[model samples]
Target chain A: MKSIAIIIKKELRRFFTDRRLLISVFMPGIMIYLLYSLIGNFLFSTPQSQEYKIAVQNPSATFQTVLDGYMQSEEVKDTYSLTVIESDGQAEEKKKELENKELDLLVIFSADFDEKLALYMQGVKPEQLPVMQVYYNALEQSSQSIYTIVTTLYDAMESSLANVFEVAGGNVATESDGFAYMLSTILPMLIMVFLFQGSMMMTPESIAGEKERGTFATMLVTPVSRSAIAVGKIIALSLVASLSGLSSFLGVIFSLPKMAGMSMSGLNIAYGFGDYLLLFANIIVLEMLFVALVSVISAYAHSIKEATAYSTVLMIVVMLVGMVSMVGTLPSALWVYFIPVFNAVVVINQIVTFSVSALGVALTIVANLVCVALLVLLLAKMFNNENIIFGK
Target chain B: MEEILRAEHLRKTFKISAKQRKIERTEERCKVAVNDVSFSAYRGEVFGLLGPNGAGKTTTLRILSTLIGADSGDAIVCGCSVRKQPEEVRKHIGFMTSELKLESFFTPSYLFDFFSELHGVPKEKAMQRKQELFRKFGIDRFAEVKVGDLSTGMKQKASLVISIVQDPELIIFDEPTNGLDVLTAKVVTDFLIELKNMGKSIILSTHIFSLAEKICDRIGIIVDGNMIKEDTLAAITEKRSLEEEFFALYAQIKGENL
Candidate 1:
């Protein structure tokens, strides 16, 4: 225990003193905040334009009336200035124009649009009878306006036809832009990246760097147990990575609203001291797991460069997994709850959305602890292996 | 005299994969690295294990220090079996290697204190030991400088100070002065002589035969994982000069091979 404490102190001193490591930890969060804020400002402040070329297919008089009404609406007039074409082929031409940066969007009205419009309002949704298809090649600011215009037109047509057909009003739900949604989509990926990056960049240097410098051999000859050395490294790395992870979490929470242009009035991100402590505890366990895994990776390599390469590949894999989890819902499985990186990502998402279950939190904590334990064991085993320690 | 360190038929073999002949179409196997060997060092003596690179000098030292376990032999250090009581063996020895580099982030004083504490020396004792070593090695004048910023000689002095801070019964140094300049090497050599006078058992492994002649009470010349010669310097250099005797031994081994 004493030896482990000493190792931990030494490691902490090294970490605090290394300028490169200190910069890596803080720079990512600052850059992320700055980039997000700039992008968000552009998203919210930019005016919508409707220089979109759209095609009308065999337009009837009533269809023309509806189209003209949309063109005249203040929201539409403020957002878009439309150019109507004759056919789908012409719409495709407009799509090519948009692809070549000539147009913003392309809208196609199919031949059966009038019939489909009638059916769409009469409570019979037209899946194949395409009333309009808007195409934008990229995620541009104007695309949001295009989506808004299309949805508004569809809703108007539906309500009018509902009156004629005497059908029940189909109330459509709008998407939420509050804390829960933001937490679900962005927080998990951010946490995973922060934790993984911190571990990848710090843990290897703590172990393999020592070996490369020849300090590890000197360390082993001390009265320190192999287990103690491993534990010390794990603890020091966990502290560093967890602190960086927390910094990143705060960066996202504070900068996200400004970036997304979403109202922060109803967003209750202000947590009590107790909530902060709990969050910190979770992050600590996750950091320990990642750090231990990195230590094991460091032991596998003979030099700092080799260790860095191995750790980079591992971080990329973790990031890819975290990203996939962000874009989709996590699978509910007991086994999934046991997987280290994946479990951390899932729990972080749940935490952000304020939907974390007690069972899930407990499971995640236990899973991470298990991972740390196994990795420390592996490291200790490696330390005892003559081939590794003696560099044979 | 009591044996401070002992290895009996110590062996370590590493299997290498090779292509098999036509009939088997399987990977053949060959054993590489350390083979069976044995030697012992008595208390209060400097024992030299002389070998060129890849002659298993480091491997033998690792086994003795409990850094690694031998494949099929037993080593005892300070009366503790390395195979069964490695922790105890580790507590009795200090190890330094030429490849082991100092952490540049810490001052010499802090580095010594850190290791003293790791060895479970009391805080007051650790401080006293640090101060004493700093003064004795003349490291006190620059004890506050980060090790990385220090000269090579200073770094080596710092390394030795940390290694001996625990005052273990046995010390193992593998090519401890391999890269030092003449002045730094003399300082290290003088320190080793001082430690010897204090009755510490030391094992110094090096390919430099002259280093062994200077301080070693006994020398074991190892070649191809085998100890070809083991004796006191006086006995080995009975009539011939140390250099001539070393060449004669080398020539004898070469002639046997031919």
Candidate 2:
């Protein structure tokens, strides 16, 4: 234990003594914050609906009145500007215009749409079900938004004919800016990405660098157990790497409101301090596992450059694993906690969304600890092997 | 003089690929690095292993220091068998070589302190030793400077200081002054003599004939992984110049191999 403390102190001193390393340790967070803020600003402030151009064919009084009312009701007026096409030839020309990007959307209502709807309101089925042909170019953002709004408008009109009110998509849940949802959705990927990257940044330098510089042989010659040396390095690396991960996470958290938009009032990103602590614990464990794995790879390499080459490939593999978070929330399972990089991603996702289980967190920690212990043993064995330690 | 280290026919071999084999193209290969090597060094004595590169001089020292295990026989250091009690051997030995470079990022003082703790030296004793050695080697003036920033001579001095910080009973140095200025070389030879006078057992390897002629009390000439000659320095240098004798023996071994 005393030897381990001395080893840990030495490893940590190497990390904290270098000013350049200190900056690099914290640089990822500052950069991630800046990057995410830029993306959020772009997403939040970029043109949502830039005056969608729509052509209507064969407008009816009931449909017109409902559309006009919706257009005037403080939401859609500035968004949608409409033109009426009287003839079939004109409707065809408008369709061409919509395809050519001259128009954002086009709606061809059946000539007897209002008439058939009135009959339908009287409990009689209308012929052909009052077909409405909607046209919009999928390539245009404005057209997509207008399509959803127009479809909602028609649904409202059809419901009014039956003297019933309906909500868009029947999802009466108030529209959210998805601020908290965004955190839940994106935070896991970010955390996994930064944790792996942070471990990569320093782990190779600690183990392989020592081997290359011949410092490791000095340690091996000492009477201290090789296991103590490996443990000290892994513990110090995990702490340092977790700091980098935390830096990135804090960057994203502080910049989230700017990304969720200032206009989105009461955005519920209601994760308490305990939840963050859980998330940080998960990050620490994940960092430990990754740092140990990277250190082993680094030890296997002949030199720092070779270690870096091997770890670059491992880094890519880890990043690909992080992509599992982007596949969305997984159904909770005991098996979910058994996957290495993925389990931490899942747990962080659970923590952010407030759906975590006590059991899942425990599994993540225990599973990672087991794997880390196994890896540290492997490193100790490596320390004993002259070929590995000397990189002969 | 009390014997401090002994090797009894220590042997080791390494398997290698026959990539250089042109005719047979067979991969079966092995090189016996240490073959039945035997030697001993005593307190108040400097035993020098004199050989050209790859002659197994380093391997012999490494075996005695327990840096590697012997394949056949064993070495005893301070009454501890290297194979069964390597950690015990390590505790009583200070092994140094160009291969065991101090980490460049560390200051000399920091490295001294680190190795001191690792060797289980109490803080106060380690500090006293550090002050004594650092001042002795003139490393005290730049003890806080990172080794990478130091001159080559300073780095060599720093390596020497850290290795001896434990004050082990047996000191193994491989090619101790292979590359150093004349003044620095003099410092190292002077230090080895001082260590010998203090009743420390020292095993040093060098191919430089002049270095061995200057300080070694006894010498062994190793060739092709075997100790071919062993005698007092005065006995070896009785008639022919040591340099001429070395080449004569080297040429004789080469003739035998061919």
Candidate 3:
């Protein structure tokens, strides 16, 4: 135990005293915050809408009154400027203008449209109503917006003329609930990725770097057991890597509002102190598992560069597993909680959305501990293997 | 004389990769690094294994130190079998070679204390030993400097001191002065003599005849994974100088005129 503590102290000293290593471990969070903020600003700010041009033939006073009322009420009169023109039988030409982008939309009605509409409003069901032909270029954004608004207004008017019953209180979800749902899908994946990246940054340097520099051989010659060395390294790496993971978690928490174009008010992110403690405990154990697994890979590698290259494959695997949080729902199968990286990602998703179960958390923690113990044993065996340690 | 170490028919072989075969320009798939080699050293004696490069001297030392295992035989160090009880063997021996390196990020003092703790030395005894050894080697002046920032000689001295942190019964050194300046080499040779006078058993490998002659009480000559000669220094040099004797033995093995 004393030997393990000494080794841990030495490793901690190496991590805390080195400026370059410290910067590398903590830089990802700062970068993520700045980049996410920029994206949010760009996405949420409303862009200037272009003025839409519309030409009408055989215009109806009733329809014009409805359009004017809708536009005036919305105070968007500057967005669409309607021009009334008499029927010149130039419908095809006007359509050509719309396709050419010169006119945003075109509206045409039959010559007796007012008479047909007046009969229809008196509860007389006619064989057919006057046809209203609308033309707009779907490729143009302004044209699409105007077409949608005008069609909506016309439909509303038509529905009111034939009203029988009404529907009320359609959607009950608040804006905050919607935002929380959005975050639940993405934040879990981000946290897993950050945790993995943090482990990768330090594990290779501590193990493979020592081998390459010949320092590991020095340690191996000592009377201490190889397992002691492995345990010490895993414990120290867990603490250091957890710091890195926490930095990224804090980054996501503080910057999430801007990224989602919303305020933190009423968001379901408020958890109790016990909940946060559970979250951190999960993080530490998960990091230990990561460190143990990476240590084995690092031990197998001949040098630090090779170790880093091999660890990338693990990174990709973890990323694919993390993306499981973005699915429709977290897996309810009890056996899934026994899987290593996948289980942690699931439990973290559960924690943030306030759906975690004690059984699931317990199973995940136990499974992670079991796997970390196994990997540490494997690492100790590798450390004792002369071929693996010396690359003979 | 009391025996401090023994090797009985030790042998080690390595499988050569295709890439290595290409680089070495050889078709052999396996290389016998050490073959049926045996020797012994006693208490309060400096036993030197002298041989040419690639003659398996370092390989023999490594096997004895428990860094690597022999395929066929065993080495007993301080009454502990290296193959059966490697950790126990390690506790009784101090092994130093160019291959073992100190972490450059740490100061010499930190590493010294760290290694002492690993060897399970008492705290006060370790500190006293550290002070004595550091002052003896002039490492006290730069003990707090990082190993990487120190000069090569200083790094070698620090490694030498840390290797003996436990004050083991047997000390195995592979080429103790392979790359040192003249002054540093003198210091190392003088230190070896001092340790010998203090009744420590030392087993060192070297190709330099003068170094072996200067400090070695008994010397063994190895050639191509084979022990060619093992005798007291006076016996090996009775008819010819150590260099002349070595070349004569080499010529006899190669069947060449010299």
Candidate 4:
């Protein structure tokens, strides 16, 4: 144990002193935050154009008056600035304009507008109704608003018709805020990616790098058991990997508002200082398991290149498992809590979503620790095998 | 003098697959690496295992260092049988190789301290040994610099310092001066002499005969996994230079093969 501590201390000092390692660990945090923020800015910021050009063919004066009244309504003006093109040729020209993405949506009112409006009021499918050909050349928030406005107009035409001139108002319930949705889903996945990336980059460099630099053989000849050296390396790598994991978590937290465009005003991502501490604890365990796995792979390899190749494939497999599990609904099987990398993704997802059960978290920790122990032992065995150690 | 390291009829046969192509089925058989070789190093003697590349010098060193188990062998290091008491053997021996690498991120002081503590040296004693070694090896000047920043010679010195920090009963070095500059090689050769004089049994394996000729009390020349000749340097060089005797042994073995 004392020897292990000495080894760990030496490893930590080496890690801290290495500029390449420092950058490899921390650069992802900075880059991930910057990339997500840029993407979020593009996703949510309102575009400059607000016009919805509609082409109408010959229409009754009353329908034209209603259309003009609907266009002037506060809701329509707030959501879209409507342009009525006069002729079919003009409508075709406007359709081309909309196709070219000059307009958000194009509403064509034909000669059977009133007839189709009646049919739509009678609960006929909107797509089956011959009322208006609504051509939305662009998909945006305003395009959906225009569809809703047209539906309400059809309903009013069959009823008292007075409500057609009145704007529909009142907030509707949303499934969840964009940030909350993203926090529940995307953040967990990003954590998984970041964790894997950290492990893949650091573990081989920790073990095979030491071997390449001649430090590993120096450690092996000491009185320290091969197991102890393996443990010490796993712990050192886990610490560095966990640091990177925590940095990624913090990066997401700090970059959330900028990336999601939704104010974190009332939204708490459950990743506060306390959560950060817990996350660090979780990450330490996860990283140990990851690094142990990597160490075994690296120990089997003779050089850094071979180790890196093996680790890269391992990391990809782990990442893919995490990714597939993230997008798919959580499996209810109790055994899923015992699988190594898969279990980590499930636990992290639960933690991010604030739905983690104590039992599930405990199982994840226990299972991962057991897996890490097995891998560490395997690595020790490999270390003791001269054929593997000397690349025979 | 007590025998600090011994091997009796040691044989290490590696199972190598004879595969002509990647997809072909292959047969496996024992390809001998160390063939029925036996030798002993007594206290205060610098024993030399002289061999060309692939002559099983490393395999012998590794087996003695407890890094691997021989297929059929009994070895003892400082009264500990390597087969049954490897941990004890590890405790009693200090092993170094030019093939082993030093971590570039750590200073020599840190590496020395790490190995000293690892080998169960008390902190105060370890620090004392560290200071003495740093000064003796001229490593104190760069003790604070990251090992990666040091020259190859400095790294080799650091590696040697760490290897010998425990001051074990037996010290094994395989090609210790393989990559050292002339000055550094001289330092290492002189250091091995000093260690031998201090009553530590040493095994120096290298292709360089001149250094071994100067320091080794007894030389074992291995060729093709076999110890072709084992004798005192003076006995082997009787009426001939060390280089002539080395080649004469090689030529005689080759003539037998022909």
RMSD of every prediction? 6.5, 4.6, 3.9, 5.1
Q: In candidate 3, what are the lDDT values of residues A138-202, reduced to their tens digit?
A: 99878888889889988998888788888677668777666667777887788778888888888
TM-score of chain A of 4: 0.75
User: B76 in model 1: Cα distance from truth in Å?
Assistant: 2.1
Interface RMSD list for the candidates: 1.3, 0.9, 0.8, 1.4
Tell me each candidate's TM-score: 0.79, 0.82, 0.86, 0.82
Cα lDDT of model 4 by residue, A122-241, tens digit = 767456545556666435565556566665775666466334465668656342344555665666566776777677777787777666665677677776888888888888888888
Task: Single out the weakest 10-residue window by summed lDDT for candidate 1 chain B.
Answer: B17-26
Off by over 4 Å in 2: A46-188, A255-278, A316-360, B18-28, B179-199, B256-258
Please give the C-alpha DockQ score of model 1.
Answer: 0.64
lDDT (Cα, tens digit) per residue for candidate 3, span B1-258: 998999999998988999999999999999998889988899889999999999999889988988888899998899999999999999998988877889999999999999999999999999999999899878999999999999887888889889999998999989988877887677667778878888889999999899888889999999889998999999999999999999999999989967
Error of 4 at B238 (Å): 3.3
Which candidate number has the best DockQ? 3
Residue-wise lDDT of candidate 1 within A118-225, one digit each (tens)? 777567987886556556656565555555666577677756666745556653532343555766776667777788777876777878888777788778877678
Instruction: Mark the regions of model 4 whose C-alpha exceeds 4 Å error after superposition.
Output: A49-188, A253-261, A269-283, A324-329, A345-356, B17-28, B179-184, B194-200, B251-258
Model 1 Cα lDDT, one tens digit per residue, B73-111:
898889999989888887888888767767788898888
Interface RMSD (Cα, Å) for model 1: 1.3
Which pairs clash in model 2? Answer: none
